[model samples]
Target: MSYLKFDKTVMINLEESLTREVLRTNRKGAYHCTTVVDCNTRKYHGLLVMPVPAIDDDNHVLLSSMDETVIQHGAEFNLGLHKYQGNNFSPKGHKYIREYSSETVPRTVYRVGGVIFSKEKVFSLYENRIMIKYTLEDAHSATTLRFRPFLAFRSVKSLTQANGNVNQSFEEVTNGIKTCMYPGYPELYMQFNKKVKFVYEPNWYFGIEYPKEQERGYPYQEDLYVPGYFEVPIKKGESIIFSAGDSAVTTTRLKSLYEQEVDARTPRTSFFNCLKNSAQQFYFRPKEDDAYLLAGYPWFKVRARDLFVALPGCTLSIDDPVRFEKIMSTAVPALRAFMSQNSLDPVIRELEHPDVPLWAIWAIQQYAKAVGVEKARELYADFVHEILEYISGQKHPDMKLMDNGLLFANGRDKAITWMNSTINGKPVVSRSGYIVEFNSLWYNALCFYTELVGGAPVEKYDKIIKALDKSFPETFINGYNYLFDSVSGSTVDWSVRPNMIFAVALTYSPLTRMQKRSVLDIVTKELLTPKGLRSLSPKSGGYKPYYVGPQYERDLAYHQGTAWPWLLGAYLEAYLRVFGKGGVPFAERMLISMEEEMSLHCIGTIPELFDGNPPFTGRGAISFAMNVAAILRVVDLLKMYNAE
Candidate 1:
């Protein structure tokens, strides 16, 4: 039995299967995303979506989907599914699906009469290519296969119609055809391993509806162009490989390339292995020396905060310290460039976020713990010293090191923290001034940097450390025992948020053991859910638990009462910090509860967040890097505790 297998019952039911999506990505920022039944429910869902830097920054969907038809004895079975207008599905290929499994690569088995065929999809690990292998398991007589390619050469954020501007002509390649729908975009080469016949019948598929988009109050219908079809014959036990990519490839090596890619995949056999596999998917390497961790799948770009926050768990937790060093080596220079020259790297965005530098230091602290502090200091001592000086010296435009030894950020207009949902150019949750997490991270970074490079640097910031130790507890701790979310001069937001968990979770915290216990207990009581920790306590006013509805409504509720799985890393760390061996069982149970999520919304991967209320439904980005990384970190932590 496969770890992520759906039987015929679930496969045939549209309601159960359509909600479950599968995502595959390459290191070069190309992705293949669709539902389990191969139906695209969102505009982001596609067969080949990749970044077109020549056109723009956003990812463009070059190949929307491929419709496959199985023919036996001149009887054709159209094995392709598409949701049309009026809630209708065309071709209705999902009915032929006998089973869907994603243990290694995503494979779907189909049965038509006596014929049993399977389709396995593999995205090339290092290139912008997708390969599909069709195997005929059992057949009664001679069989033929036809593939129709759907083309949508537009940004994933926008849709296209039947435009006369599109160039319909295609050029012949090695046992294939290459077409470029528009200028400034890379030509997509679609090749088959074996000889096939290409019929050039250019037509537009109109009124294809994306229900996921309609539900989100966006334009849901669009037109996709079909560039004819490819026909080939197959024997009972024969397998044919089809490849689609931006560049042309040798037809003879397609099968060998597909096999090599499959051989390198890590099987999602268990909960931890599943997460580890998902973690590796976030890694994006556009250039030879440059590397980054994408924030999430389908939509998000490479964000600085997300990259740092997810780097350690995504790499270190998977027992790949070399990858961790590779990514950090690339990011540290970018961070320095931004700090000194105010130059943001084109690939990694949002470096100016007030808390990004702090999070970067935290990620390095994790690396320090993994490979002893001495080794980390030898490598990152200067970089760490530079970041600390930049923050404490008040070089950061958005963040200020105040007299009370806390970093104060003004989030009235622009969102400065990770709860960065904005509406009409203003932050939905204006967490300005002395934020609990910012100060906590600030104190932690200062302590870690000083500890990393002792002697002079330690003496230089000794008074500031003492000031934070005294002012942090007095300023944030309220009468309710839990720390305030933010303190703005005389005004205070007393919402019980998970932000305070960092105070106890950080390697070096300003809070006393008793204070840590109080903060952790409050978080566990009000914000903790089976999914993770809620952004805000439900008892607080303006708390909206469900992250649904239109864009505006969703943004309003995004951080109000939404439960974030990423926060579990901090909450669990704080739990172990306060309770030690006694908290291991509870922590284990919490981690076990997350195993159910591996089979949920996106198989073998965690979603960005969940609804804060019961039946904590997964929401937001289907496969989030932060959430996956956090879970992997917890798994690593548990292993260490068990060994002890």
Candidate 2:
């Protein structure tokens, strides 16, 4: 049985069903998301969401949802649910849901009286389109299905209002109708494979509330426009395909187009198979022939730091070196100009993060391990050299080469590092100094570059390594035995954080065997949870056990003490490195919850984080790509250890 399949019990419970969401994505950047019961509780939930490059860079919710109704024997059953102002849910469509499964593409089975029908959603692998195929499983009598399409032509971050700006007009195509709500948006096509009657009654749907947005203290109420309904008859043992796309389709070939998409998908039989499939959803090939991994669903776009951090597991776990090369090339255009710009921030955001270059080098090293050093050099040597030279110069204050041969990143006013949560225009956790992970990654990058190509003066590189080896451990180690999180001008932020794991886990470390062991022991004792390591140990005064409430509270607790599942990969690496083969069973035990997680929350994918407290509840972004990659890495590491 598929673990993601929800039975009648889960489907009937409104509270439970609302909490569990399903996601489907096309490799070209379009996606479909909604609650298990087909009710949208969050502002991000939509039937079709995709980016419109001509209008704006961000994603827009062109088609919010399609409410379906079944009619038989002059009786009507509404199979759609909607939440309005004052916490009222209309129609209660989930009552008719027999089962909902995301095992393949999102499939929902509904039984309305003697008539049984199933709805399966599939996204085109190469285009911004979604097709929902409805099949009548059993019918005692003739039936009709009415589909009302709700349109929200606005950015995903904002809500829509019933304004005069909306163009309430539509044009008829072959077997579809094309409509554009306003200017600066793509024309949306709602089509079907067979003949269907379209009733043109356009009106605004007002007072719709999104609970998740209300909880986040944002404007939660919005109005969506409905472009009438389509009346399509249902025949026993027959299926009809409903297509929605940015551009008009060849309506006659709709079934063939959907069939091709379904046939192209890889079979997902096991939990790991589902995870591997979900991991593939993150990889999108944009116009430049460059493949980029989205950080997470709904909100996050591709970031320079997140791309590298997620690359190793995404590519190496699947043994796709060509994909690794494709993703790596996406960073080249900006990185090649880093030296001239005197800054390494490749993303459009104004913030400067020093960890981007560090993670990039680490990803390169991982690529080398996967496809050998020779192939890796042929692919990444020039890019790596350019990045190294850029970092080798005097740049931002938080990320600079110090006289003591250590890389110092002291982002005083700006939280430039990964602990980049700011509240009230100030950092929540101010970790600005010669951080442990920064130096370790810097050292690793330098060593990898030197090994790859030795054009740099050997004496200068050697001198820096010798000085770092002499000073890193001596200055950072506190009495409790782990390295300080950061140190700036005699002031040491001595909190135990997961960042120190990189000090031992990286290809080149600045720690001895004994020190590595000490660091691992401290981390395991205070920070290691079943899911991952906490951002801060409980011993620290700044620890926040729960990640809850609005934006400010969540941001303050984001890195304060929240347990990040992605950090588990690094901790497992350091644990295995220090303990060798003996750590395999324990590492395996730590990952057993992942199998359980496959059935919960966002089915078949790991959450971005969990609460710091016991019974660490999954929080933050659901279906996070980095978290999935981290788990894949640990699985690979354990397999290697067992082989040895």
Error of 2 at 437 (Å): 0.7
Score every model by TM-score. Answer: 0.98, 0.96
Model 2 has an lDDT value of 0.83
For residues 434-512, could you state the per-residue lDDT of candidate 1 as single tens digits?
9999999989988888778853558767878999999999999999889998999899998889999999998888888
lDDT of 1 at 8: 95
For model 2, where is the 10-residue window of minimal lDDT?
343-352
Off by over 4 Å in 2: 343-351, 395-397, 453-457
Q: Highest TM-score: give the candidate number.
A: 1
Relative to the true structure, candidate 1 reaches a TM of 0.98
lDDT score, candidate 2, position 296: 86
Best by lDDT: 1
lDDT of each: 0.92, 0.83
lDDT of 2 at 87: 77
